[model samples]
Target: MDKAEILVIGSGPAGLKAALSAAEQGAEVTLVERDPFLGGQLVKQTHMFFGSKEQYAAERGFKIAEKLSREVEAHPGIRVLCDTTALGYYDDGVVSLEVKGRFATVKPQSLIMATGAQENTLMFPNCDLPGVYGAGAVQTLMNVHGIIPGKRVAMVGAGNIGVIVSYQLLQAGVEVPAIVEALPHIGAYHVHASKVRRMGVPIYTSHTVLSAHGKDSLEKITMVAIDQDRQPVAGTEQELDVDVLCIAVGLTPLTEILFQAGCKMVYIPELGGHVAMRSDTLETSVPNIFVCGDVGGIEEASAAMVEGSIAGLTAARNFGYGKDSYEDQLAAARRELDSLRSGPVGEKIRSGLKRLSSFGEVTQ
Candidate 1:
């Protein structure tokens, strides 16, 4: 068993930020990552982030991860456990994990679950083929492992993940046939959409895959434009010869532990499914444990980092490990959170925040 003043699970942008913040506040922090390396999805992100300079926007995500890792390495108060998957959590802030092929348990005074989000899969005829993969998996293969998943690919979903991965595939010398979206317009940023468009990858709006055909592997795909009701229109079927089908429709929060631990949940499709109702401090229904990052909801890395900091600082304060000015530190964290959620896309997040805020009264 291992113990720390603060235990942060996941080691992505959220977990790293959480651990670093807590350490800076003089709390002993242990950061656990499921992967053999730290940086979670940040390592997969090869593109520059958007937002303000304070958030390291315009910098490539891989570079940002390197910088963050360096910070964590410099901090003596922070212990990073790589290749450790936190299997589950208990009500007493105790966690069970598999660490480098060994079983381990941790009981921390404060817990921050930054387990991040998982890909939301869409089902269609023959969608379960071997050549099909989540957009994130494609990234992991190309960016991390230096291996291309396939030569020609048809990406299903024109959202940010789909768009970004398509561009990255092009970078790695893979051909992207088309990005199919069931909506009339691309669901990602205009800049990302334009980048793929300029590269000659067609964006098929109001379209959905009818079937992905292949015996042992994916050999081709048939797609068609659909009406507002998502029913395929007649005579719009087109077959694209591609070996891979990448699904990037969206992400869902990895909230199984939160649910298992008996945290109150509210399902908001906009927020990407059942998330713990949290206070301004990022405290969940369970008072001593906090939830942050994509596990809270699917948002940008910028928002995830801010939320992680909020959870870490709040955790430190809860454990009586912070300075006399801990309240002021928390106030600063709140300001950071507010700034990240104040953009055009933030209107939807405001609704999520409102939903999460309601959890407090239910407990009282």
Candidate 2:
């Protein structure tokens, strides 16, 4: 059986950092990505990130991705597999994959799952309309493909993705009529809210989109004020003549592989959806199998990268690489992640993860 010390999936911030760190610390690593190009979600993120200097603070997402991608490519200890999809994981870290149009299997001593996340959808009339796109899909079209989704857009949900995508639409000269949120207050950071507000996109709190109108495509949308129970109030419906309805309600972790391979899973609405339970080093219940980034929980990219580093470092340490420095690096990464998941906004994530790991001393 062909084998390597480490195999990483997704090549997002988490996978990139994990693979690179694993290689730097002493393992022969293979980093695989399904996309033709590298960088995962970072490739389509045009805005600067918010974090400390070590986390690529103030740098744009695309730039940080590019930098890490270069490092991954130049590292002789690592192999890059673009246009690759890991189809299955088995006992002993055996993975079946489609690589460059050919089916293959990889046997690695350790495996890291950094598959990231996908956009969530909301149920509504005509939700399957042609012009209704997921927030990530809309962001990809405008930011990556350089094509605006539509002339006028209505952003559903005022979470970070919704607000950021709305701001990006403005930069692309697209019209954003409003950002609708079912909650009493905007869910995204104040910085994001203020920027979009200053640009004239009204934030409608306690509002919910009830339907998207038109046959075969989106022509307009209907929304209403929601009551305290989150139910639509009577006689509060409003219709907007928007071309596209972008749904950015939330995201869900891409942890199917982990689930298939028999890892413990937990559902945490705050963390997006079902996530794999892992240790501080990011190792899942399965021995030598690790998870980080959105696959573990739907945190931001900065947190994902830090988690990736921890997973890689810990994996390397287990394999007898950088034995002295591994623990120190892992501790630092954990500290950084803890700091990021603090404060008022991070309370939900912190609590969710705590619940996931509450059952101590697990083995598989």
lDDT of each: 0.87, 0.89
lDDT for model 2 comes to: 0.89
Q: Show model 1 residue runs off by greater than 4 Å.
A: 358-364
TM-score of each: 0.95, 0.97
lDDT of 2 by residue, 66-166 (tens): 99999999999999999999999876667899999999998988889999998888899999998888999998898889999999999998989899999
The weakest ten consecutive residues by lDDT in model 2 span 355-364
Model 2, position 205, has a per-residue lDDT of: 95
Best by TM-score: 2
Off by over 4 Å in 2: none
Q: What TM-score does prediction 2 earn?
A: 0.97
> Candidate 1, residues 138-169: lDDT per residue as tens digits?
99999988999999999999988999999999
